[model samples]
Target: MKNTLKNKDISQTPFRRDVLKIFNSHKNAIPLSVIEQELSSYNRVTLYRTIKSFIEKNIIHEIVISGEESKYALSKENKDTPYQQHIHFKCRSCNILFCSELDKAITISLEKHKIERLDIQAFGICNKCNIS
Candidate 1:
């Protein structure tokens, strides 16, 4: 089966489709390890580089939780394509990166200039992983 999701070389990697599946299924945040486990066959370096490419392409964004490690999740733009502009959240304890809707959570309007690349991140305890 051909992967309609255009992230990488779809012709070669069927497992890559699982990565996109996460975006479709979960509205919450996810980390690289979670992604790796979901995809199954993907290796460490390959997954890492694949994630790096996703970040570069704006298919997914990275997050660095304050006092914790980093995580990655999909962007929230409805185009279903790479828009390269959106906000994210990071859980301090879990280090999970969540793709949040900027317009809803935090109203942001740039003066005159259009927002080409958006990387808004909030680091704290997430609702599910809150330590308190």
Candidate 2:
């Protein structure tokens, strides 16, 4: 965790470390409410700021799904890629949001437009849910 912060040039702070730990422990993206529940002693504003900082540094990314609170997950590092371009899947049975890598690269072309980031979401029963 400390190495991740260092790589992103983020200062090593106790609160930041704790927040990263929460993200690391979970395989799925989490909402702010969950983080608050886990770190109940921390101030809400502080947590928000920490999340913002991580986003700015590309240490994490936000997942926005309709009719639900925004969720956050650690960014997958790709030294050659400047932006994250992957699918976010939500299991309807478990309601767990997680990232999934695309099988092939997606190509998009827009006339006179620049795309900085792309977030695609799919909702269905995930593998674990399908087996049960």
Candidate 3:
């Protein structure tokens, strides 16, 4: 049940429940645009506000890709929550998301910056998605 219902601190936002619901269905990250499209009830302002809160609270982290759209996934390891931080990989062809091993995670910050949190996303074709 822990994985099912992630403890959320959303006192500041009204549409917070809707925003948290976004991560419940998918195993991978979804773009803000896509999430907006999926949850049509909340208006743009609410979505943006909720996203901002989530980012600030470390509930979600941004996924960076070269040509792909910006994506966001839950940061279970965030201080606000008990979830553990894990890296992700998105396939170009199949678009499937995989949770990479934390020990195997390649990103390592040598120096501490002003950044509050960091997550690494490596993009490429997975073994099954690879073309022969």
For all predictions, the C-alpha RMSD in Å is: 5.2, 2.5, 4.4
Q: How far is candidate 3 from the true structure (C-alpha RMSD, Å)?
A: 4.4
Candidate 3's clash total is 3
Residue-pair clashes per candidate, as listed? Answer: 0, 0, 3
Compared with the true structure, what per-residue lDDT tens digits does model 3 show for residues 70-93?
788776665554444466888888
True lDDT of residue 87, candidate 3: 66
Please write out the lDDT profile of model 2 over residues 1-132, one tens digit for every residue.
432677677899999988998998898899999998898489878998999999988888898877899999988863547554689999999999999888776777689798666668899999998999
Q: 9-123 in candidate 1: lDDT tens per residue?
A: 3333555566767656666666666676766577788777766766666666667766645666665443464444456666668755566554544446789887555467677
- Overall local distance difference test of candidate 1: 0.61
Q: How accurate is candidate 3 locally (lDDT)?
A: 0.69
Worst 10 residues of 3 by lDDT: 1-10
* Candidate 2's TM-score: 0.85
Error of 2 at 41 (Å): 1.1
Candidate 1: deviation at residue 8, Å?
Answer: 7.9
lDDT rank order? 2, 3, 1
TM-score of each: 0.57, 0.85, 0.69
Relative to the true structure, candidate 1 reaches a TM of: 0.57
List the global CA lDDT of all models: 0.61, 0.85, 0.69
